[model samples]
Structures are given as C-alpha cells and as structure tokens.
Target: MNIFEFIRDPSQIGPWFHQLLLSAGMQEWVANLIGDVIGVLLIVGAVLTSAIFLIWLERKIAARLQDRVGPNRAGPYGLLQTLADIVKLLTKEDVTPDGADRVSFNLAPALMVMQIIMVAAIIPISAGLIGANLSVGLLYFIAMSGIASIGALMAGWASNNKYALLGGFRVVAQLLSYEIPLAFSLLAAVIWTGTMATNNLAMQQGELLFGFIPGWNILVMPFAALIFFIATLAEGERAPFDLLEAESEIVAGPNIEYSGLKFAWFYLQFFVNSLLLACIFTTVFLGGWQGPFVDQFPLLGIVYFFVKSLLVLLALMWVRATYPRLRIDQMMTFCWKVLVPVTLVVVLIVAIGARITPDRSINAVIISGANIVALLVTLGIIGRSLRRDVQRRKAALPGRSTAQV
Candidate 1:
C-alpha cells in the first residue's frame, strides 16, 4: 500500500506476516495474538528506520551549521551511511573488561533498550493508532522514562571503570534534577486540562481560539512548554546538557567499556529519547495529530502528527548545532534553582486561575499571561542574583575590575 492508504487504514496495511496468519483461517484469538506480535515488530522496524534517517540528518545538520559538506557519498547524500555503520557495529567484536561484572554489564544495555521501546507504546501517531490507551497514560510515560536511569547506573557500576562509575553518578544526579521540573511542568498542563490521559490532553488542544489559532496548551502555558522542552533536552542527554558523556572530560563516561553492539545500544537510546521527546511535545503542546480537515479525513492525522513531530525534531537539531555544553554545576543549578521554582509557581498560577475562572478559553489565556509574567519575574530575580554575586567577587579581588574579571 501507498503512504496515503497506509495512513488512512493502518490496520488494513499488512507486512504479510499478519496477513498470512489471518489468511490461513486462524481463530480470532490466535490471529489477534499474531497481529500484536507483528505490531511490535513493526514498531521496532519503525524505530530503526527513524534512527537511520535521523542519524544522517543530524550529521548533515551539524555539518551545515559548522559550514562544511556532509556525507555526499554512499547512495545519494549519504542516506546509506547509517546503514553502513550498523553493519560495521554488528560485525565488530564485543569486548568485556576483565574486572567488569559480566551479568550486570550484559544486562544493562538490554534493560535500557526495553525501557526505550516501552515509551513507543504510548506515543500516539493519530487518534485511532496507539499500542495502548491507559487512563494514566501520561503518568505512565513519565514513570517509565526514569527506569532507564537505573540502566545507566548499572552500566557505570558494572564496568568497574572510574570514569564509568562517575558517569553513572552523573546520570543519577542529572536525571533527578531534570525529572522534577519536567513532571511539574507537565502538571501545569494537566492542571489546565484536568486529565493524565494523553489522548484527552490531545483532545483538549483541538479547539481554536479565533477560528484559526490553535488552542494548543503551549498557547496557554508557554513557560511550562519551554521548561518541559529544556528538561527533555537534559533527559535525552542532548547538547548543552550532555555533560554525562563529555568526551574530553570523561572519556565517553558510562559506556566507555562497551564495544560494538553494546555501544550501539547506548547510541540508539539517545535518538529514541529524542524521537519520543518530539512526539510527547506534539501531543501535549502542538495539538497531537491535529490539523485542518482532519475531522473530515481522520487519516490525515497521521500526516499532521508526523509533520509536527519533524518540525520539533528539526528544532532540537538546531539547538544541538547552536549551543555549547553547560558545566555540570551550571546544568544542575539551572534545573533546581531556576526551573523547579518557576514551574512550581506556574503550576500554582494555573491551579488558581482554573478555579476562579468559569470559561476555559478565558482561563487558558489568563493562565498563559500569568505564566509569562512568572517567567519574566524569575529571570529578573536570577539576573539580580548573578549581578550581586559578580559584584561581591569583584570586590574580593583587589586588583580586578568587573570587565577585566
């Protein structure tokens, strides 16, 4: 089937395995079981496909940003580069350090891979297309995301390398620092919509304010949206917040001992989290699977969802190209001292605004205004604090002026 047909009728589009099972006149239960297995396989295939595309895209974007040519060989603009890398990794040796804990070292990568795959289950491509629709879907997604931190720690401890162990500790600190603001920012959105189900959140974003402007939660809570995106940047270990594996400083950090496929697993998890971040951002803030005429042609939702997600993904790539990595101290300080307090105030503002206001449209706008105000206020306070610190330090230095210092 073509892309249009597949988008319009996902269940009807077959990979032949499920089709063969159904065509054999299998019982309903058996057919469903086989189909589900195929669905999982298909999802895995999709992740691999996306990884291949995104890997190439990242290098191209980075090259462009750095003013150089990217891959022009290997099948038209280096589309086959990722494929070649995969083959190389799969064919290479798998080495284990003698001091490494064999069981934990082997199991850590698999555990992280499992958690990454689990996230795909709740990512909605369209209204009717999802692996499962739990009532607490958003909550579940948040909880499951943190489990991979354990795998990170395990990878570090199991390696018996000092750098790996420090990397593991850094992962724990980074995850804990970011996850709090991420959760509260999400709560601010939930406070406005009053549901933890991702689908319901999507539905809430479906309305339009002036018939053309989308009623996206981002419009109502831009601060939360910004905070959520930043937190996810840290969570995904992207640039600027990716101190966990600062090559110059730590020599590859937690995965230093992992060779071949095990290292590939670590690499895969980064892009997976990136993809999932874009999807969740679409669902919560960009109106998931929502666009013009989607009501009339519901299948168009898949197109809309992908388009939105790609735009977000591109923005992330741009950020990676533009920003330099933060100091570990700065990364943690920004999360705890800035994001946490700001998100808490935003949540409180949302809660109060929702309670006193009768109309959702009016309340949403008011809450948005309040969030912006709070953001500005927080920035002002931070600026003042930084200036004060600078002044005190300059005073302590007898020979240094502020500019010279």
Candidate 2:
C-alpha cells in the first residue's frame, strides 16, 4: 500500500487516514506529521504576508490622507517597509519595565498574535483554500475576537501601568459594545444563507435573486453590511473608536511598556487584527470571493477575495481619515442607543420576511424604505434635541447693555 493506494482505498484509512500509506510505502505517522507541519507553515506564511502588506498599506493610506509621505524609503515605494521595521525591532533589545509582571508581560503579545493567526487560518481565501471550513465559521471568528480582548486585558494588567490598565478596560468595553450589532448583522446573513461557514454562505447567495441577477448578500441585506462595517471598525479599534490606543491619551495603551520584538509583536497584532476584520467583512457581506466572472474562471475567486477585502480595508482607512474620534460617551450612545435598536429591528424584519416569503427574494424597496424612515426619524429626534440645547445656551447668555459694558 503506497500513498496512492492509501488515498484510493478509503476503508484502509478509516480511523487513520494515512494507514494505508504505511502499508504501501511510507509510514502513516510520518506522512501525517509532514502534512500537519506543511499546513501550519503555509498558514503562518499566509498570515505573516498578509499582516506585512496590510501594515504598509495602512501607513501609506494614513499618510496620504494627512498630506505626508509614509515609509517611502525602506523599500520600493515602501513596499517592504514593514519588513524593514520588523528587522529593526527584532534586532533591538527586549526591555521589560521594572513595574511590569515579567511573565505575563512577555506572554501577552504572543497570546494576542497567536489567536489572530489561528483565526486567520480558518477563513477561506479562495475556493478549496480553507484550512478548516468549520460549520461555525462566524461563531469562531466572534469567539476568536473575544480571545484577543483577553490578551489586551492581560497586556494591560501585566504592564503594571495605569494607562495600560485604563486601555485594557476601554478595549473590554469597546469589544463588548460593538460585538452585539456585529453579531446581529452576521446573524441576519447566517439566516439568509442558511449556513455558518463563510464559503458556503457566499456560494448559496451566488444564485439568481429574481431569475436574472446573481445575488450578493450586500444587495439583499445592505443595512446588515453597513452595520457590520461600522461594528467591525469599532472591533478593529480604528478611528473614531480607537480609544484603546489613543496616543495622546494612553501613550501606546496596553503595550506601553513593551520594547524591541515584544513591541513589534503588538504592532503585528494590530495589522493582523485589521486583516481579520477585513476578511470577516468579505466573508459575511461581500460574498466571500464569489463574483460574476470568478465562478466562470475559478482562479479569479482568489483575486476577487483580495480585491474586495482591500476595498473594504481602504474604506476603513477613508473613515479613519475623515471622521473625528467619538467621545467615549458618544461612542457608547451610538452603539447602544442607535446601532443596537436598529440592528435588532433589522434582524426581526429579516426573520419575518424570510418566514413569509420562504422562496421569494426579500423586497428591497420595503427594506430600503424602512431603513430610510428609521434614519429620518432618528435624525429628527436628534435635531430637535440639538435645537433645544442651542436655544437654552442662547437664553443663558445675558443681553448686552446700551454701552460697550
């Protein structure tokens, strides 16, 4: 029994999928071990490559928005800037702050970086490209994000700095607040597609919506896409919601005391985390690489996935450039008061529509109309509140006398 025979004869490899290979030519354990090692290396390489590219792209985008050049000297147009930075950091000495807990501080960055890499492995980059196409892909992504928060808390606690502690608390709050609407929007997609695996959800949606157009989740559930994007931005701790790493306030936040490669680990985690959010956005809302021409030519699926994810990532950068940071109170209010109720209503409406229609597509006109109405009503209430505040401020000001006094 050779490797070929092992693959051909399924029964011989029942409990041990490679046992037949042992019987034929190669030892079963060796073959399995080799495969596992190869798989892990591939996953690590992919994750590292993505993290490097994303970091460079983010810096470039941020700089361009601010009318400054970013990292243009390290490599061609700073293409290899992140790599150069990594080398510089790696060569530097690791310095643990005297107040920091040595063990936990050393371990925190590894924990955060590892979990993100693990999550990255589960996302499908293209057809037949997934490391693990689990039934609970969406659930796994959420759970993995929760794990990253633990690392954040650990980093904050181990650093033994007040700023780090405060950053940790903020991150915990931020993650908890945004995770709700994020889950809700993804839940709508799950219900619509009838699968939790990202790849399957996208494929199921690739069919005709009303006998002609190939359906994307975005078209059927645009609001979900919008909510998911907002929540993901918050989750990624990007602008307007990036209180965790507010430089002027926290001075690098949880990794404040870190130096050398340890600091690099934290930086790497940030980029990796951004990529994870983009990947999830691609998975849940943008059809996970499924597109018009891609299905016809399977190779295009990979290109489609990267292109779509990059577009989403660039949009995130755009928001970071355009929007000011939300005050903590405003951030909280936006998540709970505005996003929560609206997403809840959206979910309910989607569920009802699904039950009633069964086979027909959801009425875009009805859904869009409802979204507009909700937006207008919320704006109207907010406008009224602002007007009353303005009036009160004006009334509180004293009238000027006849003279300059």
lDDT (C-alpha, whole model) for all candidates: 0.85, 0.79
* TM-score computed on alpha carbons, candidate 2: 0.88
Badly placed stretches (over 4 Å) of model 2 are 1-33, 362-369, 372-376, 379-405
Score every model by TM-score.
0.93, 0.88
Candidate 1: tens digits of C-alpha lDDT, residues 1-405 = 467766555634544446667779997679888778877987878875687788888889888988988987888988898999999999999999998999999999998888778888777787757776678888887888778899999999999999999998999899988999989988888887788887778877888865667889889889889999998898888889889899988888799999999999988888877888899989988889878887766787889999999888888888888899999999988988898888888889989988776777788778888888988888899999999989888989979767876
Root-mean-square deviation (CA) per prediction: 2.8, 5.2
Q: Highest lDDT, which number?
A: 1
Clash pairs, model 1 backbone: none
Residue 281 Cα positional deviation in candidate 1, in Å, after optimal superposition: 0.9
Which tens-of-lDDT digit does each residue in 183-300 have in candidate 2? 9989877876789987787677677766875567777777778889999889988888988888988876788888898888888888778877888888778878787675555566
lDDT of 2: 0.79
